[model samples]
Target: MRRQAVSPSCQQLGRPRSGAASRRGVLSSAAAVLLLAAGQRPSFATLIPDAPVVGDCPECIGEVNETLNACPLDAPSCISTLSDDEEHFAAPWQFDGTREEAIEQLISIATGARFDMGLIDSFGGVRQTDAAAYIAKGVLAVVSGGDMPEQPKRQRKSSTEFVPFDGDVTERRTTPGGAEYVRIVLGTGGGGATQASNLSEVIDCEFLFLPDDNIVDVRASSRVQPEGKLGSGGQLALSITEGLVLDKNVAGRQVERLRKALRWDVAPVLTDFNPAFNAEAPVWFERLFDPFNRRNKFQPSGLAYPAEGEGEERPLRLPARE
Candidate 1:
């Protein structure tokens, strides 16, 4: 695991930050799988015309299998982990929700049951929550006070946008295409890294309500190609996001079965001993990370991104609008 970051600066938003999007694995009869952004066993089988991709390897799977076999028995539940990105700090944190409410709220924060959200900080070291928190922490609480698109009429969206959190830096840019473009900051690295950058990079990304599957998948890969030819720069990198979906049915079934056995409100499976909240979900591994497949109605998270290189991330020169 990497060293924990100290007093990292929070990203300014119009969208979420791009940090460590990984997952862990657990062995299964057919294949290994991880939850969240990491993806299903074979999400993207990029052949590169004739070049080899991740699927071209065999030993990788074996190494992953051995790792899952060693997953710790102790794990935390959604409540504790939720405290970070979600914080149901509304006094009575945990809930004894009705079946319908449970399903609705489950859709809101459920991780593994559906291949929609990130891994269980357990799988490998994904730190899936960072992406959501990057936005939730910085935007959700403040968007209402901003001077831009009033939160979309739709409560559930895939991505949205905002101006730089910095006031003086709020000089907006109008796209050549006659559209509006917003600026924001993104976290360089965390889970414990240095502070966030004061100098914001201008990219065309959006704020979104990504499907939990967007962060985790068992039957697919979740990756977005940067809009340019080569890729992002070394100085200030840029990232494209891909998402996943959970078999809501499968997740519900498992929760149902566990509910019957444990007779608990929400299943205890979400609990973890050494609970990790960030990118520690061990995304690389396939099993511990891969979500048990079933089916669910995945909603689009209104996170936004630039339209191709229309507003790709570029290093700010005018001493960030601070």
Candidate 2:
């Protein structure tokens, strides 16, 4: 029989589904993380700690030196990627409070939404076609990766992903990191993409993740060498982009009331993760993220349950994770 390498048991990980899993006190400080390996997990945002590991490249450095990190800042919401379904919601949960309350609220409410990774690029098509097919069928993925942004014509932008919509979206915003822009990706057509290098050179970015937290943060910082020939294919450009772009949907019953009262029509999706991903680390990893979006691609069964009574107002329940 083959012998297995002796290693740290799951119990010795020192992080067995912390706070929210237990549904109790606020989760461990954002600085704390689930230890899968002994050290050096690259942070895609908040999924993995910003701690350094051995043989690491010098380009990607975390926001802070891992000190002076505090609450609210430490709040999980700050770290998570907000979901599109939480438009206009009165956030009943906070990152610093009881984890149970946050979990309870999430479980009680139906988070109506779907997470999908689409394919519209040939360069990455061969690699991601399988994953794309899965999402098309409404299957869920915990984490996904495939292809480079070869589809959607290249404008001037940096990217870690492509959007689901292939055409014009009524509303679009510049992705955080001061790099990504909003543009229509027409299915297989190359629409909006960043500058390119040799078609053969595909940079592979493996992101570390923080599960259970609605707000999973992943990001990277880069620095080009001081000297490299431009025409010779040598350029040192440093760019750090937080992974995951959150697009929200319209929700809530305050359309006319709020429009007239506030003199502004606020779409419900405004309640999602910040339009711009902060370069800083989050304090609470799970509180701000949608439970379903945390570890898998979940489609809520009922985005919004139809009204139960003829003339009664109650919380509009949405979908559940698939």
Candidate 3:
């Protein structure tokens, strides 16, 4: 994370300062002392604390230092290659909080958006996507949690790790550091995917929390091939890797509004290690019809579309990873 000092002027804006600034500052001195006594740190826009781990995560337990140290700086995209299928990529991000916080934030951000209909719209080509809308929505969801009775339920329950969308088989395993990991995979072209289908698309994603490392590993492969064509070599594969800081202190009615838009249920998905999944009917259904759950209008940027006659093109297959 980049480090910079906050200027006194910036900190004092809107609030009365206690130093030798003005009469208001002198009057606020006692209030400042009370705040300090209460253990409240003055807000510093540029200041962020060191990443802290809370629980034992398999991949992070023994490798905290190495993982945090290896996380790449924020960039338009990651330099590390994800696979060898002549198609790979990496996309990393920097955040303001811990790894667990980042994971929750990512879920909130990704699910809050309207599903990208490839060929017409995409979240990538970051050039066209609205970063503020994405980040703001996620922050609101986290801050509001289950407080808004009007908030919509964004997630559905799923007992089986692998749902029919990615594939029927979701796999769980231990990483090198013994961290619990969930993998969702889908493949349809040649000898790659398990479920046999003619569609030439593949999605492989791994979700894990590195509590020890204070990192969330969201790595995946997205590939596409020409339909009904044999080894056309027109496959497009991109690898994505992201590291984010999550802020747990978000609060405000804006978050409640966002929760309604995302359809997120405040109920915990995993209770004491048992997943509620969509096995039982949702506990709260009032938010679905809430007038406040307004959908955002989306306009797709054509960056994801291929040039005319690029190959025997197939419709894009978006991943539905939890």
Q: How much is 251 displaced in model 1, in angstroms?
A: 16
Model 2, 24-81: lDDT tens digits are: 4334323344432445332221111122232222322232221111111211111112
Task: Give the alpha carbon lDDT tens digit for every residue of 1-322 in model 3.
Answer: 3234555685557785455667766667877788779975343223222122322232111223213211122211111111111112222223446655554544433333332222212333332235445566667877988332233223332334321222222445455765545443333322233333322223333445543653334444222222322232132322111112221111111222223333333322222111133121112232234423211111111112222353332333342212
The parts of candidate 1 lying over 4 Å away from their true place are 1-70, 73-93, 108-322
True lDDT of residue 175, candidate 2: 26
List candidate 2 stretches off by more than 4 Å: 1-206, 221-322
Task: Give the whole-model CA lDDT for all candidates, comma-separated.
Answer: 0.23, 0.25, 0.32
Best by lDDT: 3
Q: Could you give the candidate ranking by lDDT, starting with the highest?
A: 3, 2, 1
Across 1-322, the per-residue lDDT of candidate 1 in tens digits comes to 2233344355532345344321211233224334333553333222111111222121111111111011111211111111111111001112353433433333322221322221232224324454445456557557667533232221221223211111111112333433222211122221222333311111111111112211110110101112222212111221111123221122112233222322233323331111232122222222234544111111111212222244442221221111
Native-structure RMSD, model 3:
26.2
TM-score for each predicted model, relative to the true structure:
0.13, 0.15, 0.24
lDDT, residue 196, candidate 3: 33
Question: Which candidate order results from sorting by TM-score in descending order?
Answer: 3, 2, 1
Candidate 3 Cα outliers beyond 4 Å, as residue runs: 1-87, 93-169, 173-180, 186-199, 207-322
Give the candidate number with the greatest TM-score: 3
